[model samples]
Target: MKITTIGLGYIGLPTSIMFATSNHQVLGVDANANVIDTLNNGYIHIEEEGLQKLYNNALKAQNFKASLTPDYSDAFIIAVPTPNNDDAQKSCDLSYVKSAVRSILPYLQAGNLVIIESTIAPRTTEDVISPMIEATGFTIGEDIYLAHCPERVLPGNIAYELVHNPRIIGGVTEACTKAVKELYLTLVKGELIESSASEAELSKLMENTFRDVNIALANELAKIGTDLNINALKVIEMANRHPRVNLHAPGPGVGGHCLAVDPYFVAAASPHLSPLIQTARKINTSMPAFVVNSVERLMASAPNKKITVFGLTYKGNIDDTRESPAKEISLMLQHAGFDVTEYDPHANKNEIMIEQACEDSSLLLVLTDHSEFTTIPETATDRMSRAHILDTKMIVKNCGDNVKLLNLGNMHQSLNKIVQEV
Candidate 1:
């Protein structure tokens, strides 16, 4: 099959390479010239495990080529971003998806299968995409086909998960579903569950929404622990021993394109019945400020107010920082008149080295759970005016006895003691 994948982003680039390597001719179209040039020159612009090698193989086989515009193909896949609109509700913004669809309208021929792999709000494929494609004067099911097959893969292990993860193939018509299934079977190693486009869209949002809500529960627990002098981590550990309990770990906040953003799409689509979802968003969103308060409490009487922060990416071991809470915390700390320096080895760029970031700093804030952050260098703390380490992820272990280590659990213990003394 010949495929034209629009939007050469984290999802699009990998999907294009996957199809190209699977013995299908692929033309990857993107608005960014740098992305096209980078792909054509046998390199990748995004960070993902084993993608560059796969891209190299596709290039060697002459199956994949990057272009600035679309070409005629048997299938057209839209994997663009559907970010939140800058409104009060933060509803789904489909401008990129709509543009991608319009860009390929000029090349649509009979029997061409149109698939939207972008995560959208429910009914968007049936209501928005169908109308746009029908505007091209083609009957959707008879002359053309439309489906919403959302990508279900993690960022770091996209290549592996893309093949292994079960996919939802939601088509406009029953015939459309069958036609789309035939195309995906060639590449998808996992099972393809058939459904309507709206179901598939809502399913993807709910998958992330479920996680976000659970995380909010954990964050709320952390706040309660802070006030009540309890160890939130210990509470989670004990609760998980029960047969049916599996609570997520509390962190500074939830981030990334999916977990933090997808729930808003759901709530905006149905505001009245989504009170739990809305409350979860508010709880998670407030975590950055909560972390800032923790920092202020711990570093109140330090000789110097200089703070060194480690980790910037949303989670650990990746370079994607689309909506990371660490960035918000850093900004908040600065806005509150604290001299701060951030260092993340995994990030594309860092202004200061880990050693320099720690120099003369009174406090160290650990946000992301990178494996390298499991132990802190003793020499890094030698020059600190005050050696206090506040570890939110609970991963920093070996800072030595010279430094005062604090986790979310022990923070309240000290605060309560201070209150008793006062």
Candidate 2:
């Protein structure tokens, strides 16, 4: 299979490399000349485990190449970003997807399969994407087969998930779906479920939306627990023992690219139809403000306290901060007059500017659960006045007598009793 992948970001690069290593001639198309050049030298622009190995292997095998311009290929996979617009609506900013399709339209030949791996709104393939390709006077379904096969790989684990995750392929026609499935069958180990393009689009949205809603439930419970002076974490733990009841942990809020954003796409299409989804988004969005308020209340007694925020990434282990709650919480705390410091082992780019702030803080707020923060040396802790600790993610285990620990969910019932007595 000769595969051309557009938008060489997190999703595109990995997907293209996966196919190329499988012996397919893969050409990655990106508008960034620097990214294309870097890949050509067997270097990867984005960070992911096992990606450098795959990139190097594909480059050495001469099975993979990247270009700023699109070229004709047997198949084209679109894996562009579909970020939500500013209107508080779930509309995708489809500029990149549109540009990729337009660039490839000139070279698209008959029997070429165009699979969209980008997360998009339902009917985007059949209605928006296909018409754009057909405008080039190419016959639809006969000359070019269009389908939506949404990519579900997590950022840090892209290589593993790319091959392991079950894929959903929805095509304009049954043949289109089958062809896309066969192409993935060569590389993907998981089953490829067939459906209409719209259904597959909705399915991806639904999966992420389900997570967002569940996380929102956890977030809501965390807020109520905070007010009641109860440990939300212990409560959730007790509930989970029922086997049928499983509750997600609450943090500053929902972060990461997919869960924070995808539900909006579905909500935008049918706003009146899905109130639960909309409410979940609203609750998650409000979490930063809630965290800020909690920090302010803590700061009231300890006036002008220096607060050190440990972890800036959206989640634990991964460096990505896209729509991260930790970032938002840090910013909110900063605005509220507390000096804030941040550290994430995975974040080497100094993207969040918290190193200087962390060194001089009076309080330590564990916003993210990055592994590095868990093992802070006693020597380092001694330099910071042994500041009070707020464990947002509940990553910290035992706190010494000098450090007062505050957690989103009350882990110790004694703490709740103390709060009640106070």
- The clash numbers for all candidates, in the given order, read 0, 7
Write one digit per residue (lDDT tens) for candidate 1, span 229-334.
8899899999999999999989999999899999999999999999999999999999999999988877677788899988888988888888999989999999
Candidate 1 collision pairs: none
Give a tens-digit lDDT track for model 2, residues 1-422. Answer: 89999989878988999999999999998888999889887699876888899888898899998888878899999988888887868577778788878878888888899999888887899899989988888766677889999888777788999899999889888888887888999999988899999999999989999999999999999988877767788899999999799999887888876899899998899888989999999999998898787776665545356887788888887768888988988888878777776677676564454434445556678888876666545444554654567788888775555666778875334344545666
TM, every model: 0.97, 0.93
Weakest ten-residue segment in model 1 by summed lDDT? 346-355
The Cα RMSD of model 2 versus the native structure comes to 2.7
The alpha-carbon RMSD values of the candidates against the true structure, listed in the order shown, are 1.4, 2.7
Model 1 TM-score (2 dp): 0.97
Model 1 segments beyond 4 Å from truth?
Answer: 417-422
- Overlapping backbone residue pairs in candidate 1 total 0
